[model samples]
Target: MNNRLFLKEVDQRISQADLHKVDNAVFVLHDQLNMQVWPEWVREEKPPLVFIEAKAKGDSLPYHKKKITYVLSSMRHFAVECQQEGYPVYYYSTDQHYDDGLSDILESHPDLVLTFMTPSEWDSRERLREVKSSFGDRVKEIPNQFFFADPDAWKDNIEPGYRMEYFYRDMRKKTGYLMNGDEPEGGEWNYDEDNRESLPKGYDVPEITGVEPDDITNEVIQMVEEYHPNNFGVLDDFRYAVTREQALQLLDEFIEERLADFGPYEDAMATDEPTLFHTNLSIYLNNGLLLPWEICERAIQAYENDKAPINSVEGLVRQILGWREFVRIYYEAMMPEVRDTNFLDFDGALPELFWSGNTKMHCLQQSLKPVIEQGYSHHIQRLMVLSNFSNLTKTDPRELNKWFWLAYVDAYEWVVLPNVLGMSTFADGGILASKPYVSSGNYINKMSNYCTSCEYSVTKKTGEGACPFNYLYWNFVDEQREAFEVSGRNSFMVNMYDKKSDEDKKAIKESTNQFLNQLDRYSG
Candidate 1:
C-alpha cells in the first residue's frame, strides 16, 4: 500500500461534505477510552467519527521521544481499528497546533457538530473550552468515564486539607476491596510497614517483558526522530504496548510474575536495575490502555488465589485506588494557581547534571540513566534521588516539575503537579504531604545499593568527599526552621535540628553554601 497516497486521499475526503452522510461527528482523541469506535450514545445515531492525532504546538518543551511514539502510534492503531469496524474515520496528522487542525476540520464541514470526552489535562481542557465557546451548542463534552472513581463525587467528599488516607478508606469501603464485610482485611487499612523491605543482595531479578514495535510503531519512531531530533530520551528499543490487547497481556504478566514481590521492594533502588520488582504499569494506566479498576481487581484475585501476599496486593491497589485518584482530584482542585506555587520560596535553577546524568553522586547518576534512556525510573528513584536532591538544593519546584513533564512517559499535568510540587518538593505547603520528603544520604543508603559505589561518603556530614545530601538536608532544615516548627508532623525534625551544637550548624551551613555556589561548575 502507498502510505502517502492513502493519507492524501483521506485528507481530500475530509473536506468533501457529500461523502459524509451524517451531520454530527464524534472526535476521538489519541488516548482511547476503550477499543470502541464510538461511545454507546453515538453508535446507534450513526454519526460520522473523526479520530485526531495531531502534533500539537509548543515545540519549546522537547517531549521524550518514546512518549511521542507511544501516543501517536497508539492513536494511529486505534484509527485503523475504527476504520476496520466500518466507521467513517478521519485520521488527521499534522505539525500544526491541535486548534489549527480542528479549524481545518471545521472548514471542511461548516454545519458539523463535534462531540468530545472531557480531556484529562488542564491546558487541553481549556483549549476544548475555547472551541466550545466558539461553536456554542454545536460542541458537546461528555463526562470522561475512563477513570475508576468519579472526580466530582470524590471532590464532594473531600474537606479542606483532606488526607489521602481518608479517601483511600472510603474507596476501600465503596469498592469492597480487601474488605471482610464491614471490616478491612486482616483488621487493617494499610500494610505499608510490611512493604518497606529493601531487596536483599544477590536476589535474582525477573526479566521484564515488553511489546515489540510493529510497522506502525516503527513509523512513529521514524517521525519523531526526523521531526523532533533534540527530544529528551533516546528512541531506541521502544517497547511500550500501544494496543489494548498488548496492554492487557503486559498487565497479566505483571500480576503473574512481579506482583508477588512488588510490595516489599517497592521503595528499593539499585545501581543497574531500574525496575526492581516494581510494576511499571503507570505508563499503560495513564494512557488509558488499562483501567485502574481492572488492574486492582486482578491484584485482589492474586491475593484470593494465594499467589501474592496481602501486603503486596493492598499496596498495589492503594496506589491506583487511593494515591492515583487522589492526585487527579488534587490537581483539578488546585490548578492554574498550583502551577506557580512556591511554598518554600525556593529559586535555585535545575542543575546541568540532571540533564547530563554526570553527577558524582551515584544515586542521582543511576536514577537519571534510566530516565534519559527509557523515560522511566520507579517512584522511589523519583522521590529519593531526583526530587530529594532538588529539594535539598532548593531547585525551583516549577523547573523540576517541567523537567518531569518532559522526561517521564507517565507524566501528565494532572499527575505531575501534585506528585512533584505537593508530594516531592513540598512546594504546595502541606497540601499533599504533612512533612517534606527531604532526607540525607542515610535514607538512600537504607533503601538501596546505590551508596555502596558512590564517590562521596554517605557517613560524612560535611566538608570534602562528604555526600552533598548530608549538608544540604541540614541546611534546608535550618533554613526552613520556622515553617517546620509550625508543621504538626514535621516539628520533631525541627526539634532535632535545634539540638545540634552551634558549631555543627555553622559548619553545615558553610558547606551547603559552598557546594551550592560551585554547583554550576561541578557538572559532568
Candidate 2:
C-alpha cells in the first residue's frame, strides 16, 4: 500500500512535455491491460517484493534527514507507479535507517526479500544477505536489472592483467554497437580525445524545456513541502522520469536530440553548460523503470534509420555497453572491502558548503550552483570536480561516498558507489579502476571554466593565491605515496615528490591544513 517511492521520482524532474506523454503512457497501459492497481502484476499472487532507495549516507553537510526525504519521496512515487501498472512494491528510505523498514518488511511474510547489488557501501547488501540466510528462499536478493550488464560479467573476464580497455574492447566485439563487423565504427574503442573540447566562450546553450509534474508528482511536492521541509536539493526543477512510459520519452529525447554529440563530449566540461553534448539520462538509466535493452534498441534504430551518425550512435551505445555496464560489473566483481579501501587513508570530514554552495572556489561554486538549481551534474563534474576535490583534499571515503549518493539527483548507490569510492577516489584499490583519478587544479583548468573565475590560483602549488586543489593534490599524493606505489602508476609522482625540497613539501602540508581548517570558508 505504500507506493510513494515510485511516485516521487516521477514528480521530481519530470518535464512538462514528458508529463503529458507519461499520462498518455499510463492511460495506454491502463487500456491495454484493462486493469489498474500495481499489485495485480503480482501474477504469482506474491512477487517477493523489493523496496528500493537511491540515497546518500549523510555523514556530512545537509545531514541524513534530507536524504531520507528524497529517497522516501521517490520510493513512494515508484510504489504508486507499481500500483497503477499492477505490481507489488515494498520500500524503505535509502538511508542509515533501513533496518526498521526491513524488520517491518520481514513481518509482511514475503516469499522473498530483495535488494539491488551495491559496490559503494557493504552494509546495504550485507544486511540483505543476512536477511536472506535467515529467511532462505523467502529472501532472494537480485542484481538490479536497471543496469545493462549481467552481475557476473566483470567477474567472468580475467585476463593476464585486468584492465578496462580490454573489457571495453571485448564488449565492442560482443555487442557490435559501434562495430563494423570486426572493426570499430570510429576505428577506436574510445573517442575521449575528441570529446574534450571545452565550451567555447559565450557559447550559449539553447533554451531547454523542463518536465512538469502530474497529480502524483504534485502530491509528492506536497509531501516535500510538509513531511520533509528541509531537503537540501532544489525542488523547483524536479523532473526525473519515474515511470516506464515516461522513461521512454527521456530515452527518445537523448537519441533524437543529444545522442549525436554524446560520445565525443561525454568527458568534457563547461561552466555554463550543464546538459551540453550529454544526455541527462542517468536518472532514468539507474531506476528500474528504464530498460537498457530498449535504450540500446533506440540508439541502434537511430543509426539504421540514418537519423544519427555512426560516431553518435557508437558513443551512445558505448556508455551503455562500456562505461555503464562496466561499472555495474566492476562493482559486483569486487566489494565488501572495496568500500573500505581508502587509498589515501583520508579521514577528514566532508566540508559544510558541499550542501550550501557557499565556497570561494569558482569550480566548486559553479558546479554546485547547478546542483542547487537542478540537482544534477554531468559525470565529469561528479568524478572530476566534486570527486576529484574530495580525493585531492583527502576527504574520508565514507564521507565522499555519502556526499556522492545524497547530493546528486541522478545518484543511486549501484551506480554512484564504484564511480565514487572506487573509480573516483581509488578507495577500492583499483578493482573498479586501474588507478586513482586524482588530479589538481591544472586538469580542472584544462577541462572547465571553473578555474577561470575562482579566487584560487590554478598554477600555484602552495600559499597565497594557490588553488586549494593544487596543495591538496600534492598533500594527498605525499600521504598516500605508499598506497599509490602499489598502483604502479605513481612512478612519475614519486619521482616528482622525490625531487622536491623538504621545505616545499612542508609548505604543501601546511597549505592543505590551512584549507581544511577553513573548510567552512571554502565550503560556503
Candidate 3:
C-alpha cells in the first residue's frame, strides 16, 4: 500500500479494536478533570471509557491558544495513561458542541451505561442532567471528588450573609490544617497581613523549571495552531505539566524552593518577573493533574519538616482550602443570576490592549504581556493590575468575566465568575467581596516596579502624563458614590472621595473623561 493508504488501514484497525473493546461501561471525562483521581467505585469497573475534548461552539471570545493546548494535551495524555492501565479509551477531539460529541459516543454504544462525575460548572451540570434524563437508569453521576469541601454542605452551613473567612475557619477545623485542637496553630485563621510585603530590592527571584512539553504536547500545539489560528495568546513556549508525575514534580519543586518566601511576596508584582515566588500549580490543580487536598497537605508537611515557614504554608493551604473552595461554592450558589449581575451598571467595552498588550500603561502592558504570551499571570497581577484596570475603566463585568474565562489556563466558570464578577468588578453586589477592588496608581507603585519606567507619571494626578488609574479610580468612586455610601464596607471610600478638594475632583473627572474618550487610540 502507498503511505496514505497504509495510514488509513492503520486507523481503521485501531477503530475496529476500539469498537470491539466497547462494553456495558462508559465514563465521560471533561477537559478540566483530566486525571485518574476517580473514586473507589469508579476504579471497581475496568471497562471502556469516553473522554471528550470538544472545541465548544458559539464562543466568539478569543480564548488563549496556550489554554486550549494545555487542556487538550493534558486530556490526551491522561487518556493514553488510561489505555495503558487496561482501560479501553475512546478519546474524541471534535470541533463541535460537547453535547453532540457525547451524544455520538452514546449513540454508537447502545448497551453502554454512562457514568460521570458531576461537572464543576453549572451549565455543564445542567447539560449532564439532560443527558441523564435521556439515559434514565443507565446513567449515574458520582459527586466530584476533586474538591475538599462539599457543595451541599457549604450551601447548608452558610448563614444569611456569605463570608469566606467564616467558611475558611470552618474548613481549617474540618481538615485540621494549621489547627491545634479547636484553635488555629498560629493563633489566627489568616496570615494575609504578613503576606503582602512587596519584593525587596535586589532580592533574587527563583527561576521556575517548568516541564518541557513532550511529543504529545508538541502535537497538541501544532493542532491548536492549525485549528485556532485567531486565538488570543501565542502558542510558543507551551511548558505545562501534562501528566500526574510531572505535576507532582512541579509541586515538589515549589515546596522545596519557592514556598519559603511565597507568603511574604505572594501579592507582590515585578516588571519582568511574572511568577516570582508564586506557585504556578494552579494550572495543574485546576486541570486535575494534582488534587487540592494533596497539595494542601504537602504544603503543611513542608511546614512540619521546616522546609517552609508557617506563614507560607498557612497561606498556601488557605488559598486551596479557603478561597478556592469558597469561590467554587459561591459560584454554584449564585450562578444563572450571578452571570448577569451588574450592580454598578457600568457597560463599557473591554480595551483592545487587554489582548495585544500594546498600551503605554506600564503595569497593564507588563501584566497583559505574560497573559498574552503564556496564558498565565499570578493572582496579584490578575486582580490588582488587569482586573483593576478593567473595573476602573468601567468595562462591563460580563465582558471582563468572558475575557478572563478565555485568557487564563486556570480559568473555569466556577473560579472565574466569583473572582472577576464578584471580587474584581463588584458586579455581584457584595456577594463575593465586601467592596470593589479598585485602586489608584499608588498601590501599583507600591507593589510593583512597572511604574518606575512608565510613560504615564505615577505622581501626576491629571492632564497628559497622569496615571490613568489615578483619575479613573476617582471617577469610578464619583459615579458609584450613592451605592458606596449605602454599604458600610464601601461608605468609607465615598467619604474619602468626598474629602477631596473640588479642584482635585474636577481635574480627576476631566482627566478620566479625556482618557475614556481616547481609549480607542491606545487600544489595538
Candidate 4:
C-alpha cells in the first residue's frame, strides 16, 4: 500500500516462472551497489537485482537535503547500470520501512529467494534479519566486502585497550602497502607530525570537478525536494558523482592535482577554500561507489611514480587503511550503549548558531558555510573548530552527535557514532580516543585566517569583545581539573591552569559565565 513510486520495474507483478527460472535475486542495499563485491554466482547467473528507497528510513532523521539526494541518486544510477548489464532490476520507491517494503516483494513472489550483503549499519542489518525470520531460508545474508577490515578477524586479533596505531600497523603488514619487506618504507609508521602546516595567503587550490546532474540525478533532486522540504542544507549546486565511473574520474583528479600537497595542508583551513588539497572520496567510499583498497592503491601508486611524497601518501593511506577501518571495528565493538554514553556528563544544548550559521564568530561562520551548503567540510574543521567549540560550551555529546548525523553526506550510524561519541565528544571516556580533542582560540588562530577577520579579539583572553573560546577553554580545564588529574595523560593542562593569577582566573570565570548566560537567553 505504501509503494510510492516504482521508478524502474521489469514487471509490476513478477511471475512464479520468472522467480523460479533465476537461481535467486540479489537484494542490493544502497551502500552495497559495487560489482566487485558481488558473489561469483551473481556474475555467472546474472540474478535479478532489488533496490528499495524506504521513505521511513529517510524520515528517521532531519538529514541534510544533499545527503539524501546523494544516496538516492547514486542508488538509482547503480540500479540502471545493473539493468544495462543484463541483470533484471526491481527498484521500489516506498513510504514503508525497508523490511516492510521487502515484505510486499516477498508476498508478490512467493518462490523468490533474496540474497543480501550484511549492511554497514547495525539497525539495517537487524531489520534484514527480521525479514529472514518470516521467510526462513529465502533470505541469505553475506559478509560485506566494501571495507578492508574483517569484523571477525578484528574480534579475534584486537587486544584489550584497543588503539588504532597498532591495528593500522598490522593492516599495513597484512596488505604490504608502504612497507619495505617487514619494515615501513619510510622507517616510520606515521607522518602526522609533518601534516599541520597552514595555508599561506593567496594560495590557489585546484578546482574540484563536479558531475552535472543527468536526468536520473535531476529526477532524484526533484523527488527529494517534494518529500523532504524541511531538510537542512541547500541543493543549489548539486555536484556529487552518481555513478562509479564519475567517482573514479574524481579520484584520478585528486591524485594528479591534490595528493602531493595534501599532507602539509591536511590540517590547514582557508577562508576562501573549503576543501584544500584533500580527496573528497569519502562521499563515494561510504556508499559502495568506490572501494577502500583501490583508493589506497591509487595514492600509493602516485607515491611510487614520484607524483606524490611519502608524507602525503602515508597520510592518505592511514586515513583509509588505518583510521577508517579502526573506527568501524570500534563501532561494532561498542554499539547500542556507546550512542548514549556521556563520560563527561555535560548536558548543555547545541546552540542555534549551528543551524542558522548566524554567529559573528568568523571561524564558526566559515567552518559552517560548506556544511550548510554542501553538507561537508574537511576533517580539521569538523574536529578542531566545530567539535572543539561544542566541547568548550559543555553541549551534550548526544545532541552534537545527532546534529552531525543529520548534517554530513558521508555520515552513517557505523562511522558517525564512533567518530562523534568516541573521538569528537570523548563521550565514551577513552574508548576510541586517549584524551578529549579540545583546543582554544590559539590553535584556530595558528591553523586558519578566520581569526584575522573575526569580530572578537583573539588575543584578548578575558572581558567583553574577547574570543569566547579563550575563556571557555580555561574554564573547562579548571572545572575538569580533577578529571584531568585522574586521567594523568593531560594533567599538565590542569597544572598550567593552576599557575594562572587569582585575578586572571576570576576574570575567566566571569567572562565564561556571562557569555553562557547570554547564549542561553538567545537559545531559549
Q: lDDT of each prediction vs. the true structure?
A: 0.81, 0.62, 0.80, 0.86
Query: Can you write out model 3's per-residue Cα lDDT over 1-524, one digit (the tens) per residue?
Result: 01121123223323322644455555555444543567654567666667666666424456789887787777767767766676676666555656666667677767667777788877778877787888787678888878888887786653335689999998999888898999998688888888989888899987888778877777777767777898888988877788888989988898888999999999999879999999899988887888898899889998888888888999998889999999988877787878999998988888878877889998998899889999989999999988899888888888889889999998888999989987888887776777788889999999988899899999988888999999998888888876565468778888888899999998988898888888862233
Report model 2's TM-score to 2 decimal places: 0.77
lDDT for model 2: 0.62
Compared with the true structure, model 4 gives a TM-score of 0.96
Q: What would the per-residue lDDT of candidate 1 be over residues 1-524, giving only the tens digit for each residue?
A: 11242243234334422424557787776654464333676766645567655555436478898888887777766666656555667666555656556666776778777888888888878887788888788788887776767787766644336889999999899999999998999888999999888889999888788788877777777778887898788998898888878889888888989999999888888879999888888888886778888999999999999999999999999999999999888887787889999989988888888887888899998999999999999999999889999988888999999999989998888899899998999888877887788899999999998889999999999999999999999888888876575466788887788899999898898899899998862222
Candidate ranking under lDDT, highest first, comes to 4, 1, 3, 2
Q: Backbone clashes per model, in order?
A: 0, 46, 0, 0
TM-score to true structure, per model:
0.94, 0.77, 0.94, 0.96
Rate residue 283 of model 2 by lDDT. Answer: 60
- Give the top-scoring candidate (lDDT): 4
Residue pairs with backbone overlap in model 4 = none
Model 3: worst 10 consecutive residues (lDDT sum): 1-10
Candidate 2, residues 33-64: lDDT per residue as tens digits? 11222233334353323443333333334533
Among all windows of 10 consecutive residues in model 1, the one with the lowest summed lDDT is 1-10
- Model 4 lowest lDDT segment of ten: 8-17
Q: Report the number of backbone clashes for model 4.
A: 0
- Over 352-470, each residue of candidate 4 has an lDDT whose tens digit, in order, gives 78887888899999989999999999999999999999988989989899889889998988888888888887888776777788888999999999999999999999998999999
Show the lowest summed lDDT stretch of 10 residues, model 2: 23-32
